[model samples]
Target: MTEPILPRIRPAIAALAPYRQGKQAGPDAFKLSSNENPFDPLPSVAEALQHTTPINRYPDATAGRLRARLGERYGVDADQVHVAAGSVSILHQLILATASVGDEVIYAWRSFEAYPSLPLVAGATGVQVPLTAESRHDLEAMADAVTERTRAIILCTPNNPTGPIITSDEFATFVARVPGDVLIILDEAYAEFVTAPDAVNGLTGRLHEKHPNVVVLRTFSKAYGLAGLRVGYAIGNVAVLNAARATGIPLSVTSAAENAAIASLDAEPELLERVAVIVERRTRLVEGLRAQGWDVPDSQANFVWLPTAERTDEIAAAFGENDLVVRAFPGDGIRISVGEEGSIDRVLEVAAGVR
Candidate 1:
């Protein structure tokens, strides 16, 4: 049979590479590539997924109950909360809603991998300002780069992969500089994992009141151990969130995810204890790497960064050989998630050898 000819496709999308998740591991290995919660789902969360979801029927298309629940948690009106499959989904929806061909979306470089591609998918241009020497966002540089064509800006606090967070003061100053018309997405995906005293916690600070243009994104995928379930939300002003909701695919969030997330919230006290454990582990991992003469950043998230520079690929392969699965960014560095307790000793041992 002859190969069928393809129909017309957008030049930008056709050339775009798909999002790549972290590397998986074999049974004998622990997958430390994805910055996932090391703990299993709590009893309540599992029970909700098993019993609360009725698979034979479609879920609530609007997820009204979940929206109200999250709104209460963040002290916002129901219309101000937008629930989607994940925070990343809301990101795509917002980019599509606000930016389009000939416009620009700005974010920090060496940030969440999704930042670069999400803009292209929306047919918008991306402007990436490099991080500071200490591996934190150069917010001033990002603000300076914005133009009249800029429609959206995404800020990942406890910035993924590298792991430093944007402090509350830094955030306030940055917001003041940005144009009111530009949509600012403050991705707090790793907020629960942060242990820093001054780091930005959007919900606690009531960001919505002061910055109507900014939206805070949170996910049940990280600290809640709901990664496989796929549930997340955005809290922002009514008009901005409504615009994002309009662009989203209907009912992409299943009843299973919504119920599980609600259950997770019900079990917040227990879940936060587990987060404390991960934070402690992260502290140990950072100290261990730094002690081994490696240039590791102070991470407020569940992962530690190894700024391997030219040896990124080589070092990543070495870890793989030892059954320690980690994420590598070619020439940049490696991001090793703080995983099983048993994995810690091995990680330190591997680092000692590399040093």
Candidate 2:
């Protein structure tokens, strides 16, 4: 007989529904579900992986070498870089390090689905600021929602589902208005794909210089095409990053992942060329969708978003029936990744018929 397994765990832990990843974007399936890079890892990255020694040994617990390389690339100190299994792990660590029971965590709803859940996992309260009518984050409303208990806030720029970005000036103003101690996470997973002149590259400039409380999260998953390798890092003030590091699980990042990330940085020129293609494809996808009478928003990321929740299921089913899987959020909208040349055409055709 099973002794009450349900009652033995922490209520917060018991209440969590496990995180769900996007559907597999298989080659045969015209997959556009996850917003993964359409290209493969760089040749240098592949070469580095072949020489990765003894998988039997534990990975560098501090991710020291990777941190140094990242520091060099971003112009931040090695002490400020904290590598994790992926940006998702870094995001989770940020929440767990700051928020605790009854404290509030704020972010835009429908931005990153994990944003609200991460706080809940830490036994913290969540505040979801509603998006504007245009499906962009209402930064002013988020600012208004803050209180003494609000410990952290997440800002996913060129935001995940909406694909719209808050300009550098707007972000600067927003950051200025927030309390100094509140941890602000600028998750820039798609930063490499952005072409907007005003778009803030958090690590490359002013945000890092001016805001001590702000941390930028980046990944090799999107533009660098290293999603399967699971390497990412956070850039911030050394003290805050140190705190996050102290709270993070040691040796969670693999040596293979570290090696791949370092190689990706070294191979930036080629990677950026691939990124340019994705940007062009994104423009094509958006314009094509709009020409077909779809209400798509201005996107700065690797994906485009539909504006109405009502059309989400229909659009998804249309693609799925044609062996194209896409991410759909109920009462939110549909999100389709801009994939290879032919895949976008499939998405457009299915989208054209969704009605």
Q: What is the Cα root-mean-square deviation between model 2 and the actual structure?
A: 1.5
For model 1, which pairs clash? none
Task: Tell me the lDDT of candidate 1.
Answer: 0.91
Which segments of model 1 are wrong by more than 4 Å? 1-3
lDDT of 2: 0.86
lDDT of each: 0.91, 0.86
Model 2 TM-score is 0.96
Give per-candidate clash totals. Answer: 0, 0
Error of 2 at 135 (Å): 1.6
Candidate 1 lDDT over residue span 51-116, tens digit each = 655678889988888999988877778898899999999999999999988999999989999999
lDDT of 2 at 96: 90
Top candidate by lDDT: 1
lDDT by residue for model 2 over 13-115, one digit each (tens)? 6777786788875558866778989787777989989877588899898888999988887787899899998898899998999999989999997788788
Task: Give the candidate number with the greatest TM-score.
Answer: 1
